[model samples]
Each structure stands twice: as structure tokens, then as C-alpha cells.
Target: MIDKVVEVVSPERALRREAARRTLRVLNSGYGNHGASRTKKSLIGWNHKGGSPDDDITDNLEVLRQRSRDLYMGGPLATGALKTLRTNVVGYGLRVKPQIDADFLGMSDEEADEWERHVEREFQLWAEDCDAGRMLDFYEMQALVFLSMLMSGDVFCTMPMIERPGNPYALKIAVIEADRVCNPPGVTSPNIRGGIEVDQFGAPIAYYIAQKHPLDSKSMQNKWARVPVFGERTGRRNVLHLMEFERPGQRRGVPILAPVIESLKQLTRYSEAELMAAVVSGMFTVFITSKTPETPLGEAVPLEQQVDVTDENSYELGNGAIIALGEGEDVKEVNPARPNTAFDSFVMSMTRQIGAALEIPYEVLVKHFTASYSASRAALLEAWKMFRMRRSWLISKFCKPIYNEFLYEAVARGRINAPGFFDDPIIRAAYSNAEWYGPSQGQIDPLKEVNAAKIRVQEGFSTRAREATELTGSDFEMIVRQRTKEEKMMREGGLLTNASENQEVLGVPGVENEE
Candidate 1:
């Protein structure tokens, strides 16, 4: 029996060995151990003494070393392993099983089926490669790859602001990672291991860490300090600092200036901070005007007419005070400013120039300004009253129209079978102030009214039937007699007009009787 068993297994074993040999040869060709000595003394090392060592053990070790080297050298085996590892790791299922076994265990049938499918795929891949050791290596690779993916930015997570009544601009500025925690199922926890506790099932059940934005001193220096000073000038002792805060670098304690410069450049067009910086740097320019002398030396003309102080290039001669920027030698006048009769004419002129550049007409700008405290309070009260009144008015106007239409349609359709439609509180309130009214007593009982109308109609038709009988001509009688005869014949032949034989006969067609 032993001989037979060996004979059967020997060929299969030989085939597996041949396959492994071929795989090892392909791997080694790509990544050979270039520096290792080929001498037997160098190759032989530790040996197990329990039994005769397998001759193929050395070859297997060499193959494993070659595969590891291939991966290190950025070869195909390494790439394949990485790709497979990533897929397996990201695809692995982690779920929170409910504490109740009956509720949770059988509840995840669909999920369990999906997981089984995934495991089957892994098994299929493993089966294709006959080496069990490589299959184990793949599992280890899967775990490492999954950890890396979890650490990456694709996860959704959030951190709390460091400051109370936090700066809106700083809040907007903070960068958030993408692969952080999400409320959705299948996403991994974003917190550090010590911060959040996971259940025995590897599910995050609770968090211990305080939510906080990580702050770096160098990065947040401008935000924390009223002003940041870079270095003092030697002579004047003037402090200098960068216009904007620096961004934190990946390495702890380092700061990057590029983001600050980019942020400043982006702010230059619209932000007041950028404008203030420009003004302090003396990049801005301004203009001023001077008054002219009353009259020329030998002119008989009136002083006002004859007065000519400067040409349009300097300042237009007038009591008017204009200020503007200097365009080459010419003065380009801006809007005029209020001239206070204090200080030297030149200083006053400069003040007027500055005011002119910034000033806007009160009538034009006052409307754009928000109302101050007292005015705002008055406006708010007025708005509240108006809103309440308008709402009440709308309810009154619209509800009545809807109610009337509904009642009218319901009556016309013979669908309303009960009384008190008008007596409904909603309807009574809506119609309280109406000048014209519907029925003042009460709504008609619809079912009774319908029955009465139906009875009257029947009675009227019966009276008409009697009139027709009294005035019956030979032709009309002949027609009715003929129809009656035909109906009787049909009934006798087992073909009746009525659906069922048990049904009572209705009154004659096109005829009525008073009784």
C-alpha cells in the first residue's frame, strides 16, 4: 500500500517541484544575487537536527531571497504584489456587529455573502500559485497595504478650532484631510489608536481624544500675536515682519513662506489688509489744490472775473477746493472735500486731497450704510408688525376662496353627505367679516336634500307618465307593445337583458307612472 501511495503521489509531487523550479528560475533571472559567494561553505549555515534536511530547502530559500530582491528593485513581481496587496487591503470588510447575536448575526447575511465572495477571489488567486508560503506573504502584504490606505487623505475627518470666537478667515484657511472619518459605513476610523477605542470586533465604538486643530508656533505666530516682528532695524529700531502668516510644513517645527506670499498676492486685489499694507509702504499718491489771487494788476474787470491764479494744469481758479493725483506735470482733479479753515494752506490742501480721494456723497452713500442701533430697532419693530399683519390678512383672503371653492364643488358633485361644512371653525373664522354671506342659519343636510330631490324627480316623472298615458296615440302604443313582445321572446329563449334572473324588473323604458 505504501508503494502504491508513493507511486500515485510521486508524479504529482514532481510536477509541483517542476512548476516551483520554473517560477524560481524566472524570478532569479530578473534579480540575481550578484555579490553572494557560490562556495558551499558560504551557502551552508544553520541546519535542523531533528531529521535529514530536505535537499530543496536551500533552493527554496534562494527563491524567496530572489523574490524579495525583485520587489526592492522595482521589478514586475514587486509591482504585482503591490497591486494585489492594495486591492485586497482596500477591499477588506470591517463592520460593527450588533451586540445581540440574533439581531446582528443573521442580519448580516447579505454582507457575509459579499465577504465570502471576496475571500473566494483571494483563494482563487492563491490556488493559481501553488506555493503556500507565497500565499502567506500575500496576506501580510494585504495588512500593510490596508494600513497605508487608512492613513492616506481619502478618509474623511474633522478637527475642532483652537480658539473661541474663532477667526473666520483662519477657519477658512485650515486644510482638512480627505480620507478622514465619515458617518457612512465601510470607512475606517480617522483617530489615532490611543485616541479612539475599538471594540473586540475591530470597530470604533468610542473616542477618547479631544477634537483640536494641530497648532504650530511658527505657523500660528501672526494669529496668536497682535503683531509679529521679524527683526529690528539697527538705526531706527523699526520692526519688520512678513505681511502674512506662514504655513506649517510637513516636518514638525518647520514653516514655509511660499504659501504666505501666495495668500498675500491673492488678497492684494480686494482685502483691506492688502490695501493698508500698500498705503504703509508709500505706494499710493495724492493731489491738492490752492486758491488764486483776487484780481490781475491792471484790469478794470471785476475781481471775481479777473481772478486767475493757476492754469488747469495746476488748479482750476475757483473758491472750489479740488484734490487729485498728479499726472506728469498736470493735476487730475478728484472730487472736492470740505475745507476746514485751520492749519497752513498747504497742510489743509493735503488734508483736502486725502479726503477727496476717500470721500463719497452723503446722499449716495448713506443709503448703502446699515442703520445704527436706534434706527435699526425701530425698523425691526415695524417689520415684525408688518409681517404679522400681512400673514393674518393673507390667511383671511386665501382660506375663504379655497373653502368656498371646495364647498361649491363638493355640493355640485353630490359628494358631501353631512351637514356643518360652513360651521367648521376654520370656515367660520375665515368668513367672519364678510359683507355678503352664504346661508345664515346652517348648511343643508346634503344626504336628506339629495334624497328629497330624487323623490321629487321621481314624482314629476310619474306625473309626466300619466299625461303620456292619457294622450296615448295608436302609433306610440304600437311601438311599446312591439318592444314588450320582443323582450319576452328574448327572455324565453334563455337570453335575458337583466344580468341576473333574481333581479326585479325596473319601470318600462321611456315611460312613467304617478303611483
Candidate 2:
């Protein structure tokens, strides 16, 4: 036999190999720490592969964009998160109420009242027909389209029927499905632009909206073309692109569900497995053994001798049914897989993370309130911060601009009275000034909250108008007018309000007990 010799590498190569191996070892260690604090986010083993908070999102936006939107529509947790957010964000509908800047308009109280009435009348008339076609009114349209933005990451609105017959102000908004904004006809990609064309400043210069949805199977789908952001012959006011921009330079929106996609998939799988296991646990399997010495125990029985479950007797195995076994045959109940004790804890844990990912508290996301009052209220307060912020963004991006445009068309057509409407910017500002009120989060303890509000108002820390609007989603001025009418009517009927009666009871102790 030949002597075996171990080949030795050069010293330099040995050191290089050792360094490479050490690098890999460090990487596979499941910790990206360089002697950092254990509590530091990046050093956490679970978050090792995740990019840091400072990581630039512009580079990978396009990659995660479509898939995130798809999962938001089809994935359960994704859909729930979107629906939950949308409900809180715009469910009550941001009701538009004209609030003319009195100082800017230099109008007296009586003139301002008239101006408000005229503005409200014109606004209601236009809003009734502002939605695309005659199908949905403005509020319904807002909710539907807002849901799309939450689901698809972006939505397109076109003013195609601006000058529709019988419609005043020539203001109409038609919703275009997000998928239509794609590559130009017969082109895969030239400049890596996904329907949006941006200028050198990274500002949106034009939008390429296809006539048909990109995934539509119709034969005429190929005929759809991309339209410019501002049509040269038509005009720019015709198109509206709404997207939730996450990064400074990012062009398109990534779905709100992006962070929870993987978790949703795993949760779905776990739920399905549990359901299957539950079904199988109720089932029983048959085992047959021969009692005679001629046939060995556990020996396979001949086909002809084996018992068969005919269709007529199959019902015996069904719920609440009893069955008789063949001679020497025994029934062995199938032991169902033990339901994982950690299942609920695991699902709740996953949902908590999902809620965090969506910036919604778990209680709000699930609409569950089994927690203590303080905890529940705290969760709501925290959740409302995110919701209110999103509402502000929605107002700024979609509502406020749309209203201004509506005002422009209304004023141009003389639908609303506006002296010097076109002459001065201040007049326009006063005319366009408005507030959108949504549903109020009513107090759980009404009297306590009401007393607190009254105290705050008296102390000049709050205003009745702001508090009323926040509590009722109503116009404070309109409320006072209605209350005055009710009081007059009640006085004529010889009835008095509880507030007046309470004045008589002042300084009296236990009047009810005396009575």
C-alpha cells in the first residue's frame, strides 16, 4: 500500500481561507451584532436579516410594490388590516363644512352667514353629482376609492366626464383601476418607468394610463394607450394620481400590507392545518384480527373475507350513528393531532405584530375590547394618532385639492356667488377655506366627559365650536340655530328645559329625597 501524504496549503492561503470561513460563520450566527447593546434593534437575532431603519427604500420599492398590493387584496390578515384602517380613516366620511376666514374676507357676521349658506347650497348641489357617473355620490365614492388606495397602494382618478350634459361646474371624477397604469403599448420597459413619468427633479410630469386593465383578458385590451399627466390639447386638470409616498424620492407606493405579508401566509397555513386536524380527530379507523389459531394475529385478511362499508351502511359512521363490526374485527379510534397549546398565543402574537406593522393597535385592528377601560382607551388614543395622521394626509392629498377644484369650477360657472372671485388670491382663499369633519369618537362616560369639556371651554383651553364639531361631526352654528328654534317651540308649548329647572334647584340639597 502506498503511503498516504496530507497536502499542506501555503501560509498566506491558509490565513485567507480561515478569514473566509470566519466571515461565513459570523454571518450564519443569526446575530448581526458588533458588540452592540442587546436591546438595540439591529442587533436582535430575529431582525438580523431585516434592513435597518435608515436603509434606503427607494431602491427596492419597485420590487415589493406589486406583490404587496396583490397580497393586500387576497391575503386575510392583509385584507383585515386594510379594511380596519380604512374604516377608522374615512368611515363616517369627511363632511365638508365651509369656514370662511372672517379676517381675510373682512365680512360682518350677517354677511358671513349669508356667504356660508350660499357656499353650503352650491357645495351640496355639486357634491351630489361630483362622483363618477350618477352611480355613487361623493361620500360613497370617497370610501370605495379610499379602500382601493389602502388595498392597491395607489388609485387613479380622471375627469373624463367633466362637461357631461346636465351637470354644472363641469367637474366629474372617474376612477381608473390601478392596474391600467402600466408600460406603454407593445413595450416591456424602456426607462424602467411604471406608468408614471417623472421629471429630472423627481416630480411627476405625466402619467401613462392604459385604457384597459393590464390583466383584462378581453381582445381589445391591447388597444388601451398611455395618456400624459397634462394633456397638451385636453388639459392637466383631467387626471388625478393618488399614491402614498413612503420615501423621499420613491415614485410609486408600496402597499400598507407589505410588512405583514409573510406573517399572513404563515398564519393562514397554521389555521388551515388546525382546521384539517380538527376534522380528522372525529374519525375512527378499523383494524381486523383473526381469533382462530389458523390465522395469525395482525395478519392481512383476504379481500373476500374482509368487511366492506357499503353505501347503505356508510351512514352508520356519520354523526350520532352506531355501527356493528364484523367477526374478529375491532375499531381503533384515530387519535387526533393534539391542538397546539401555543396556537392562540401564536395567532395573537402574529396579529399583534401585524397590527404594529399597520400602525394600528391590536384592539382596534380586531375590534375587540376585552381589556381594562384604561388599557382600551390608551390603545384607542395611540391608534387615533396614526388614523388622524392618515386622515390629514388624505385630506391634503385628495379632499382639499378636489374641493378647491370644485370651487374653481363652481365660481367660474357662477354657481356660487363670489365678488372678485377671479380678481384676488385672498378672496379665493377665503372662499375655499373649509373644514372636513368625520365621525366623533364618543365618550364612554358621557357626563364626566361633558363636564370636563365644559370646564375646558370655560377656562379658554377649548372652544364650543371645536368641541361640538369633534363630538358630533356637525356644524356648531347650525346646531345653535336648531337649538334656538327648539327652545322657542318648547316655550310656546309651556314646557321648560332641564337646564332652566336646574337653576331653580341650585343651593337645594337632596330635593329629590325631600319630594
Candidate 3:
């Protein structure tokens, strides 16, 4: 009975042990197995029971504990847990709270993993939005500011009263013209059949008008608020203005003008903005605009007052309004014009002085003259001639050395041929005068010059001879020693000492010893 009990108990214990081993293996296979030894070959140990209680499985336990720690400490599992928690706490539409992981023992690895994933998802969404151009960076904001200023049309104007009435739109219009010049593809002017030719001076007339009448709100609005539409069939000068048509409820039509006006406005605005920005940025070292004070144009008649129509008030001047005045106004114009003429005389004198200094022809200076004051052409010519005479006298007296230096440079560069080289009259005349001897007190002697030239040639030849002799001395000495040794050899070999025999050996007749 004791043996039977031992046998039954032994097999039963073995079966139980086998089952426990399999259970442990299954448990150790998954991610959550915390306490199982990873190195264990079989789950059973110490006589086929199960895990030994005395055997330290602390290393395996530590590994499992660490893995669990990682899961809760902001790993994927923790990230998922946080996401689920957020969803449950805040509902679907609520913004998910950012995952917060604290490295504490109380936090589970699953919670940390869920938190990490949640943060990652939020960042990814942000990156996608940025890539899709939904956000503006620093440069974009700057561009928007510039565009707003351009669209506002107030950028180029400085008039505090531009919000009022009766201002001329010339300056703004001219600015548009300049812009057309710069960007011709985008902006162009129309061809008027008999309109005035627009030169560079005329281009800026709009700006002058703006300066004269700053209170014109219509001008300001027209300058700034219009968009231009170009039609292929339509004339380039007559761009369609959006401001011309208005909806029934709208108060004002969009004001548009020639493309030239738009261009001028852009240029003026850009220049003004650059100037202002530079001033604000502390880039300007000098305040130049305030240096010159503007003088007012004296009492001038209004454009309407000068009109010649019998019914002056009743006459409406269309765009082609030119007033013809009686002889009385033309005579009165001469009195105010004298001061202008005197001013022009003073300017001409100054210009002639400057032209003399620069050695430029008076005609060249006259071509550059463009001023409100007018001077007589003959008077200007007379003044310029005197100026040139004075300059010649000054050159002869004070600048003789300078003249000599120029002559020397010309001679050294061989730009002027030596005398008698060519038979051309100009060439002969250039070398004929005593002045051709340059600034020297006396005439140059060709014979003495030739003697000096020969001395230079002889010196150069002697220098070459010395160099050649020094270079060949060692080689010549070596050749003489070799010849001596060969001659001795020939004599020892019982060769004849006659000139003919020696010539045959030395390969030269003169090299044989006559003795």
C-alpha cells in the first residue's frame, strides 16, 4: 500500500508540474510577462516541480519591471491610454489635452505610451497645416503690409488735406507713368492723336499738381482706389476703370486712369516708403530734404481769369481748353519776365565759369541747360568764348608743366610718330614746330640722340658677351681635357704625329699641333 501510494503521488505530482511549466511558458511569451525568467530553458526547475523559491529570479523580474516602467513612462502604450482617457473625459469635439508624463513610480507604462502618441499626433497635424500654407511666416506678414499700403494709395501722398477737394492728380499720374517705364509689360499709355508729347519733365507734372493742391479727395481716391483692366482690342491709353461703374446701392464708382498713372503712383509710394522706413530705422545720416527752402511762384493769374471768351463764366472748357488772351496780357508778361531773364543771365555766367573749369565746349553745356529762366543764345555764346580765352591764358601761364607732362607721355607711348617718318601734312605739322621739342629750353639734336642710342646698343652687346663666356667656360675646359687625353692615347698607339693624321683623329684640320 505504501509503494502504491508513492507511485500514485509521484505521477500525479509530475503531471501537475508539467502543467505548471506549460502555463509559465505561455505567460512568458506575451509582452506583459513581468516575473518570468527569460533565460529559463524550461519553466520547471529543481527536480521537476516548478520555479524554485530559493533561486534568485531578480534579474528577469527587473527586466520585466523595466519594460512595464517604459510602457507607462511615455511609450506607445501610455500614449494610447492618455488618448483614451482624454476622449472619455473631454468628448469628441473637445481639443485633446497634451500628454503629460512624469517620471514617477506611480505612473503605468501604458499611460506614458498613450501620452507620447497623443503629443506626436498633435505635432503631425500642426506640421501638415504649415505645409499646406495655412500659416504666414515673418516675410509673408511684411509683404502683406506692403501690399496694403500699395492698395491704400495713401502711401505716396503726404498731404494732410488729401481727404478734401480740388487737388490736381498730376503727380500721382506721373508716378504711374514712371512705373510704366520700369514695368512696360504690365503698364502702358494710350496714343492720343494730337495730345502733348510726354517727356521726362512732363511725366512728373502730376506730382507737381498734387503738391500744389493737397486737399483733393477725388484726386486721392482716383490715384489710389482703382484697378486697371487691359483689353486686347481697346486702346492701351484707355484702360477700363473699375471705379467708373457702381452697383445701385454703392455710393462711389471705382476711379481708374491711364496705366501711366498707376505706374507713377507705385513708384512714388515705393520711394516714399523706402525713405520713411530708412528714416525710422536710423539709416539716414543726413536730413537732406530740409536743407533747401522753396520760394513761392509770385502772384499768378488763375487759369479761369485768363480765358478770352466774351461770356467767361458761361464757358465750360473741355479737356482741350486753351485760352487766347488780348495783346494787353502779353505786354504785362514782359515786366515779370525781366527778373527771370536777369536770373538766367546770372546762371549763364556761372555755367560758363564751370565749363571753363571742366574744359567742356560751351555748346555741350548749352545742350544740358533746362531751366525756367531763359537767356539769349548769342549772349551765352559770347560769354563762353571769353571763358575759353581766359582758360587758354591760364593754361599758358600756370599749367606749362602739365602740358609738358602730356607731351612726354604721348612721345613715350609712341602715339605721335617721330619727325620725317611719314609724309602726311598733319604728321609733318605735328613734328615741325619747336614746340615739338617738348618743354625743353633748346631744340633736340638728332645726331647727339643717335650717338647716345649707339652707346646703349654697345653696352647691351658687351653684357651679352660676358654672360655667354661665363656660361660656356666649364664645358669648353672639359672638351679640351678630353681632347688632350685622346691625343695622348693616339700617340701611345703609335699613330703618326703629322697634321693629316692628327686631323683624322681630332676631326678638324686646325686642331692638329703644327710642332
- Could you say which candidate leads in TM-score? 2
Query: lDDT: which candidate is best?
Result: 2
Error of 3 at 9 (Å): 99
The ten-residue window of minimal lDDT in model 2 covers: 1-10
Candidate ordering by lDDT (highest first): 2, 3, 1
lDDT of 3 by residue, 1-515 (tens): 75466557797866776788788766655433433545455634525333321122211322332333343343332223223222222221111122232343234667644644444353333222221122542223222222222222111211111111332211111112111111112233432101112334332112111122223345543222222222246312211111112233221111111112333334335445555655544421222122223421223245565555564333332334344533323212111121233544654564455444434333344544343222334434444454344333323322222222223333444543243324454543333221100111111344543454456556775432223222221223346678889788877787856767887877554675665
lDDT of 1 by residue, 378-447 (tens): 4333433432332233223332232333333343344432233344654323222221111011112445
Better of 2 and 3 by TM-score: 2
Error of 1 at 361 (Å): 23
TM-scores of all predicted structures:
0.13, 0.78, 0.11
Question: Using alpha carbons, what is the TM-score of model 2?
Answer: 0.78
Better of 1 and 3 by lDDT: 3
